[model samples]
Target: MPRSIDSFNRQRLITSYFSVTLSITLVLFLLGFFCFLVLSTQKIANHFKEQVAVTILIKDNAKSADIAQLQKTLSVAAFVKSLQFISKEEAAEKFSKDIGEDFVTFIGTNPLQNAIDLSLKAEYAEPEKLGEIKRELEQNSFVSEVIYDQSLVALIHENVNRIGLITLVFSALFTFVSVLLINASIRLSIYSKRFIIKTMQLVGATRSFIRRPFIRLNVRLGILSAFIAMLLFSLSLWGIVKSYPEFSILVDAWILLWVFLGILVMGILISWGSTYFATQRFLNLKTNALYY
Candidate 1:
């Protein structure tokens, strides 16, 4: 009968350990997912912004040699991410297809000007930098006009700022919740061993000696939970990329590094710190307080 009772208690302890480990793992996973979204938002936004182009209309009588020279100069410019020269013939063909009519046929000549389409780097996509780029390009003798959506650029900046603020606020809020949940879970797990901590105190064991083993055990659990969270995050990222192959470009090594690092830090910090504090509570508590 005594052996049967011992077996029952051992099974219960094992179940409790599993439950606490699972709880911490899930909390870590949630924190990791939040960081992934916060980090990748900028990259996704930049991808959309890079599609906005600034068109440079060339002068009607500009020599081909001068156009080639201008292209070379623009290619090396700091603000230009990419540039493509569209000849009048190519522009006319595209315009014709868009309108479903050949304007050159009715006009007896192509009316469209040769143009260079410039896509600025993400940093230079702002209205102020775009204005500077426009002014600089317009100074060229062979360039007739530089055109882009100024209002659209302003809107993009405004929207980006709003998104950043929202993400920051949510991150702070979620982080606090994650820490609380993890700390509570750790405390509950330690609460189960309140009697054991008291026993060690009665045996003349040093506080550090008692804490040393619990801290080591909890830190190991934290590391394991971190690994599990990272595995789940990786699978989630892979599934997203597989479903929408177009967004694969946004899956950068640096982002992954930061996310994994964050998960590990969160897991270790919360688990180790929570275990330390929780253990201290029981260590300092009177024997009668253990009943609660």
Candidate 2:
């Protein structure tokens, strides 16, 4: 009878520990995922921003040498991500293909002007910055006009800001919920061993001594749970990269390393703190209070 009861209690203890570790792992994974989203928000925004192009129209009478000089100047500009020079002939050909008719033949002349299609870096894809760039380019002697989709630029900027704010709010709320969940799991795991805590205290065990073993065990649980969470997080990232290969550019090794380290630290701190406090509560309870 004694051996059977011992076996049952041991199995229950193992089950309890497993449950606590799994709970903590899941919570940590969610927290890590939110952190990754917050960090990658800017990178995702920049990818969209760089897709819009600004067109610089060239004067019809501009000399080849002057056009070449202008191209060189724009190539070296801080705001320019990339630029492509389109000749009048090439532009007219592309337009004709788009409209499925030879407009140049109907007009008896190629009416399209030579232009440079400019792709600005993500940071400069703002209304104010684009306006400044347009004004700057229009001042050049060989440039006739500089134009881009101002409405599109404004829309992208607005949407990116809105999404970033929403993501930040969600991340903060999720972090708070994660902490509470991990704390509760740790407290329940300790609650199952309250009698052991009180028994040791009754047998002349000091408070610090009683806490030391629980703290050490919970810390180890935290480390193990953190590793498992990191593994799940990494698998999720791998799945994302596999589905949308373009997003692979946003995955920075250094940033991911820091995020994983943060997760590990959070797990350790929360577990240790929870275990310490939970054990302290039981230690403070009187002998009669142990039943309730």
Candidate 3:
């Protein structure tokens, strides 16, 4: 009976060790998911920013050289995220296609004006800031006018702001819930080890000496789980880019780097915090409580 009891205890310990590891892995996964969500949101916001167009109407007789120069200048503008030039011929063709049935015949010539299509950065997408940017662009001598949907831009900016706020709230909520779950998991995992902690304390073991191995184990678990989560995120991103090639920019090096670093930080922080609290609770228990 004594030998059978010993085997049972041994099996229980091994099972609990794995259960704790799995819990930590889950927490790390959640953290990475949240990081990816944030990065995706920012990319979506940039899509909106790139869609806020400002048309730069050129003079009827503006030379090709002047238009080329204007394009170069607009490309370098602080507010501009993207710029494209539309020649009179292309504009006329587009208008005719939209109107249908040879509207070009009534005009006899391409009466459509040449223009530069400008997409502003998100920072300048705000209605008031955009108006100021438009006014600045209009000051150029070759620019006949700058035109875009003022109300539409305003609406986009407002919607983006609301989305940003909602994302922040959701992230906070996820974090809170994740932390609580981690704490519970760690407590359960460490509960079985309480007797050992009390025995060490009775034997005059230093707290640092007791904590070092556990902390190291927690750190290793954090790193491995975080790497796995990041790998999954990368795979998901690659699949998305493959399916929708137009959004290739979302999988750019900079964005991927940001996501990787964010996941690592989140994993390390949450794991370390959960382990610390779990160990603290164990150390604080009354000696008699360990037997329970």
On TM-score, the leading prediction is 1
Taking all chains together, each candidate's TM-score versus the true structure is 0.96, 0.94, 0.82
> Local error of candidate 3 at 135, Å?
2.7
Query: Which pairs clash in the backbone of model 2?
Result: none
Segments of candidate 3 deviating more than 4 angstroms: 1-10, 59-76, 107-110, 137-144, 240-247
Query: lDDT tens string, model 3, 196-287?
Result: 87778779998777766777776676777678777777777779889999877656577668778876786677778777777877888888
Candidate 2's residue-wise lDDT over 106-189, tens digit each?
999998999999999999999999999999888888799998999999999999999999999999999889889988998998
Task: Provide backbone clash counts, one per model.
Answer: 0, 0, 0
Q: Every model's Cα RMSD, please?
A: 1.4, 1.6, 3.1
Best by lDDT: 2
1-292: candidate 1 lDDT, tens digit per residue? 9999999999998887787788889998989988987998899779767877999999889999999999999899888899999988999999899999988998999878999999988889998989998999899999999999989999998898899789978988999999999899889988989999999999999999999888898888888989998999899889989999997976999999999999999898899999999999999999999997
lDDT winner between 1 and 3, please give it. Answer: 1
C-alpha RMSD in Å of predicted model 3 compared with the true structure: 3.1
The worst-scoring run of ten residues by lDDT in candidate 3 lies at 24-33
Which parts of model 2 are misplaced by more than 4 Å? Answer: none
The predicted structure with the larger TM-score, 1 or 2, is: 1
